[model samples]
Target: MQKILLLSVSAGAGHVRAAEAIRAYANIGDAHLEVLHLDVMQYVTAGFRKIYTDFYIKLVNKAPALWGYLYNSSNDAQADSSIEKLRQKLERMNARALLKEITAFKPDAIICTHFLPAEILSRQLKKEVLNCPVWVQVTDFDLHRMWVHEGMAGYFAANDEVAFRMQAQGIAAEKISVTGIPIMPSFTAVASREQCAAEFGLDGKRTTILLMGGGAGLGSLDAIAARLLAMEGDFQLIAMAGKNEAALAALQALSLRYPGRVLPQGFTDKVERLMACVDLVVTKPGGLTTSECLAMGLPMIVNAPIPGQEERNADFLLEQGVALKAFDAVTLEYRIRYLLDNPSKLAEMSIKARALGRPAAGQQVLDTVLSQHP
Candidate 1:
């Protein structure tokens, strides 16, 4: 059996989630393949690991402007600041254990959902010390300079625009594959309003809307929920406050306040099921969540995508006509009401979303990687 090493860093949940999706596909689609999923953060020093994940969360949440500045300013070859150099040094020093694990595993194909491991292996491959092919999966609709490293076997992109951007940055076209961002296979399964009706208490009378914020309550879900509930319409809200206890409590309280109009869910594993029940989703355009929505053929009303990757993801969705971007609560409320009033437009958007979704992208990536093995 060919060994598959699936690597990710826990900078945010999306990278690890992408890796898990691919691993799940590998297990279910090919019994002959041996797979191992490793979070590279586990092998790094605790301080480095903590900083890698925590700094990202705090920076993006508390100091978004500063984060945006860093994101936009560092996306080029010329912008090699001292912090970047120091980060690379820290990674090399702390990830020695990870290198040993990869070298020992003797994986025939190494796939990375995050670019940090890919960068380390790029050096090893260029030195001819690592013989296996290393492929990187870009988990966002945008490409950053860090993900563009020497000696990568190939890259899997979220969409055509990302592929084009990589080429513009000098990555060869042949080295890139426009595979949609992978999600858990469960999202690809066919489900219906009838099927999910029993759980979320859906009815043919009221339009159902799903509200989520990418598993951490990062986006302004409370404000959006309040605005939507305040509006008069024949609609209901499935408020999913993923992993946010306070948000969940508030949403539950709102359910009481608005009786039959609000259905709040905490961190649950049944997001795909919820999508089946809803007419449309209001969410942030994180790559994994958007991919899930697309796979389910559900239309999106995306709001407040952070100024970097999420913004680009929202752009792709809007340009594809699968979603609409809302700048604030009032605009979001307007879009929701407009869509509710126009059922034909919602159906059209769903059709476009399905057209753009690559439900079997995980399997495609695995087959391509193994088939092209050096």
Candidate 2:
């Protein structure tokens, strides 16, 4: 079997989610492929994951400006060394062990969904210890300097804009391919909205809005859902309280009060189905979710995108005329009502969103990796 190790991180859900989608895509047929999904953070200590996760959440919530500044300022070649050193220390325990295992697999190609493992592998290549073609799959529409490395065999970006940015940063133009982020196969192939609603037992007549807060359910989703429900509109709400049992229970209790109008879901693997049925999506603008929404051609009401990467995603969607941004409860409610009331505008946005979709990104990336290695 041709070994293809997929590396990702568990700090947030987007990276691992993207990695899973690619793995699923690669394992569809009699392709002699052995896919291993790894969380690089798991190789590190528990304290390391805690500190990094906490710091990321706090930085995004409490100090967005500082985060933005850091993101913008760190876009240089010089910063790569510091980042690599930090990753080395975090993965010190199993770095060599994992590397040996991968090398033993004698993989034809290695794919990376997260940057940390890519960085480690790049370091190994620099030292002449690793000699495989490394393909970096950038999940976000915007490319940071960290995502661009000197020795990457190929870069799969989300759009032409990101590819252009990579080319500007000294990466060869031929080495960059604009393949939209890989989403679950369901997103690429699913039933129509009416069919999906029938399957979910959702009323097709009502305007359905699906609200999500990534995997951890880390956002003020309750407030936003309440505000939407309070608005006197003909809309049904489905709030996905991802991986947060307390939040799901709280929303479930609220759903009891609203009865048929509100539905709360726990962590589910059926987001593509939900997106297919929903008229509008209200969620934080994580890259993977945003890409999935685009694939489903669902118009979005962005709640709160984190300052650095997600902000870029929101901007890209807005520029494409496929989404709108509403930062607070009142604004979000108004936007939802306005869109729901005007079917023409909603139809137009959805059309634009579908036009921007790239459903074959996973296959495209796979082909690129195969061609380069062959």
Candidate 3:
């Protein structure tokens, strides 16, 4: 059996989800390949993990302009030194245990879904501590400078644009491939509209709008839902408040207010099933969720993406014509009505989205890693 270690961090749910998706797809394609998933936080203390995650959320939510400034500033040539400093910091905190765990696993290959592990493992390779191939899957539409590292066996990008970014950052063109962000297998196999309606208690003939607040339910979803509810249209709305109890409760109350027209769902494992039937998705442009929407051929309404990576992702979506951005409740409602009023325009965006979606990204990533290792 070929053992593969999949390293991810829970800084955001996207990284962990991407790692799991690749592992699942690899098993489906090659039963003999054994993939082990590890959270990079395991190397550090719980306090460290909490502080990192909390600081990230606070920075994005409370001081997005500062985050954007830092994100942009880090893209300069001086960022190399910053990254080295970060690696050294991690080295001082957790590198020894992480290296020990990796060596003990004796895996044929290591794959990282987050940059932290990739950088840490790169240091190991440089130090001649672990002798195995290392691969990284960049889980976002845009490549951050922090993700660039030397000594990777290969790197998987969401598109050719990201691959070019990687090459420009000194990675070899041959080492990078444009495989869309890896997503769950459920996204690859979509149900028809009628089939989805039967399964989810939705109306097949009515326009269906999906409102999602991302994994941790981090957005102004309640406000968005109210605005959409006030809009004049023949539509059914499905709002997914992922892991946010307060949001789910609020949406549930709204469902009562709207009767059968609104449906509220809590954190769910069935996003693909819902995506399969939706006419459009109103969401924050997180990499993994937006990729799933694209795979389902659903056009997106992205409103005020958290600065830095999400803003960059929204920009890419807008450039590709698969999504429309509305930063406020009024504009969001206007965009929804515009799409609902013009089926032809919605259909065109769906076509563009489908053209951009790569449903087989997981399988492609697995194949690339295995081919390089063998």
Candidate 4:
């Protein structure tokens, strides 16, 4: 059996999600491969892990501007600020335990979904502390400078634009593969509208819309839901307020207020099923969510992408004609109404979305990584 280690961080669900998606593919597609999915944060100190993972959510939610500033600052190699230096020092110090585990695992190849683990492994590889090939998977549509390290065997990107960005950052063009963001195999399963509607107790004849804000539920979902409810249409709403109890409660209350028009779901494993029944989705452009939606061949109306990478994700989706962006609740409502009323436009977007989707991305990435292994 071949040993493979997948390194990911919990800073956001997307990185870990991407790792799991690939892990799943490896498990089912290649029975001879032995895979271990490790959250890199677990090897770090509790405080450091919490600060990087949980605190990140608070930062993006409360002080998005500061988050955006830090994101942009890290992109500049010339601006080696003290904070960046300190962070790197801490990451290296915390990586000692991770290094020990890697040495013991004796993996043939190591795959990284988050940048922190990539940087640590890159430095170790350059120093010859580890000999296994290291593959870095860029989970977002945009490439941050932190993900570009000195010693990487290969780079897997979500799209050609991201691959081009990595190439411009000094990585060899041949080292990059545009695999599309890997999504779980569950997303590849086909579901008919009638099947999902009957299972979820929804009207089969009505146009269904899914409103979601990724896993953290960070957008103005309540406002968007309110706007949606006020519209007059032959539509049903599936509001997936992921892990947001308050948002779920509000959405659930809509069932009483509007009667059968709204269906509220918390963090669910059946998102692929819900998506099958929906005509369109209102969501933020989180790489994982967008990739999943694209895999399902569902068109998107990106309501409010956070100011950094998500904005870039939204830009790519819009440019690809798979999605439309709305700057505010009013525009979100308008787009939904217009798109739903025009089946031709919705079909067009869905066609583009399917064209861009790489449902087998995880399997392709794994094959590339293994093929490069010495």
Candidate 5:
């Protein structure tokens, strides 16, 4: 058996979800491969863990402009080598036990869904501590300089644009694979809209829209939901407040005020099912969420994406004709109204989304790795 260690950081759910998706795909009758998925942050100190997980969320939510500046400023490999070296040293120190896990597993190959482990493992590789090949799957439509390490055996890109970016930055074209971002297999599978609608007590044909602001209050689900509810249309809304209890409560109140029209949902594993019946998704274009939308062939009205990889993801979606972006509530309202009033445009967006979706990406990543290792 070929053992593969899949490491992810919990800086956001996307990394962890991407790792799990790969592991899940491997288990679907691929008995020759053994995959272990881990959250590397759990091996570090609580304070360090918070810096990786909580600080990122707080930074983006509280001070997005600073985050954008930092993100853009760090995109070049030559831009901040010294500062990055210092951070990498800190990462290796805080994440030393990650080496212990790798040693214990002694896997044939390693795949990292997040860059932290890849950087740490790259350090170890220099000293011949771990001799196996390490690969990286970038969990976004855009690539950051931090992700462009020297020791990777191969790299997975979400699309051709990112592949080109990697090559532009000196990575060999042979090492890059355009596999899209791995999403849960459920998204790609066939789901019945009528059944999903009945399960959620929704009308299957009412020009429904799915609204998600992500868990971190990134796009203000409450405010956006209020505006959408106030609009005049023959539509029902499914507003998802992912892990945000306050947002959930506010949405519940909206449901009361607009009974039978507004469906309020908290964090759910049933997003694919809810997505089955909805005609459009108004979302903050996080990488994993956007990939899921694409896999479902759902048209998107991207609402105020955070100013970094998300904005980049939105740009790609817009360029591909799969989505339209709205920077504020007024723009979002106008765009949604326009789409609802024009069925042909929405249908076109859905077709484009499907054309761009890579639902089998999880299997593809596994196949690429095993082809080399086995």
Candidate 6:
């Protein structure tokens, strides 16, 4: 039996979710696979995690322009020295512990869903401390230079354009494989829309809109839901407030007033089923959620993406013609109304979305990792 280690961070839900999807796909029972999902912050002090998470939330909530600037600056070659120094500081603490763990596991290969782990492992290989191959599964459509590192065996990208960008950045073309972002297998499986609606006790004849805010349930959800309900249209709205007890309670109370028209769910494992029954998705553009929506052939109305990677994701989906973007609650309401009014346009976008779906991306990534070991 062979061993493989999977690593990810929990700054956001997408990274951990992607790691789980890959783990589910690589269920080699006889291979003695051990998936160690780590939130790199956990290895650090509580102060460190608090500072990092708070900084991220502040950037997304208040300083989006600055965040966008910082994101763009990371792409500049001149910033490599400063960024590498910061990486070294982080690596010294958690990276040392991670290396010790990897040494003990003696895994055939290390697969990283987050860039931090990949950076640490790549540094280990560069220093001749670890010799196993390292594979990185980038969870975004845009290839940030931070994700590109020396000593990496290969990169699994989300699209051909990202692969091209990686190649242009000195990574060999053969070292970059365009396997779409890995998503849970459930997203790929087809569920009868009528069946799913019936199970949820939703009206099958009216269009259904799914409102999500990633796993944290942070977005302009309340405002958007109110506007959605106000529209004089024949549509049912379902809001999934993930792990946000307050938001869920608020939505639940609101739903009572609306009766059978609105449904509020609290942290559910049935997003795939809900997605199957919906005609459109209104959410923030996190990589995992976007990939899941694409897998389900559901067109998206991107509400507000965070300034850095998520903004890039929104651009990718828009370029693919599979999604529309709205910057605020009012804009979202208008876009939703437009989409619902034009079924033909909605169907066309859905067709393009289905065409772009890479449902077997997890398996493809697993195969690539195994090939490197073999």
- In order, the Cα lDDT scores of the candidates are 0.85, 0.80, 0.85, 0.86, 0.87, 0.81
- How well does each candidate superpose onto the true structure, as a TM-score? 0.93, 0.92, 0.95, 0.94, 0.95, 0.94
Clashes of each: 0, 0, 0, 0, 0, 0
List pairs with backbone clashes in candidate 6. Answer: none
Instruction: Give the per-residue lDDT of model 1 (tens digit) for 41-61.
Output: 899887887788888888887
Candidate 5, 159-188: lDDT as tens digits: 998999999879999999999999887877
What lDDT score goes with residue 335 in model 6?
88
9-75 per-residue lDDT for model 3 (tens digits): 8887999999999988977777788889998887887777766677777888778789888778766
lDDT of 2 by residue, 1-374 (tens): 77777888876788888889888888884367677777877665567677657677778777877878877776643654887566556655547756876777788788899877787788788888888888899989899877766578888989989989988888898888888998876777887778878877788777888988632222366656776788887789888988889888889888878888877888888888888778888878888888888888889888667778989999999999999988766677678878978999999999998888887777788777866765
- The alpha-carbon deviation from the true structure for residue 19 of candidate 6, after best TM-score superposition, in angstroms, is 0.5
Better of 3 and 6 by lDDT: 3
Q: Which runs of model 3 end up more than 4 angstroms from their true locations?
A: 77-87, 214-219
lDDT, candidate 6, at 285: 89
Candidate achieving higher lDDT, 2 or 3 = 3
lDDT of 6 by residue, 189-244 (tens): 76788898999999877799999863222335655677689898888999988888
Q: RMSD per prediction, one decimal?
A: 2.3, 2.6, 2.2, 2.2, 1.9, 2.4
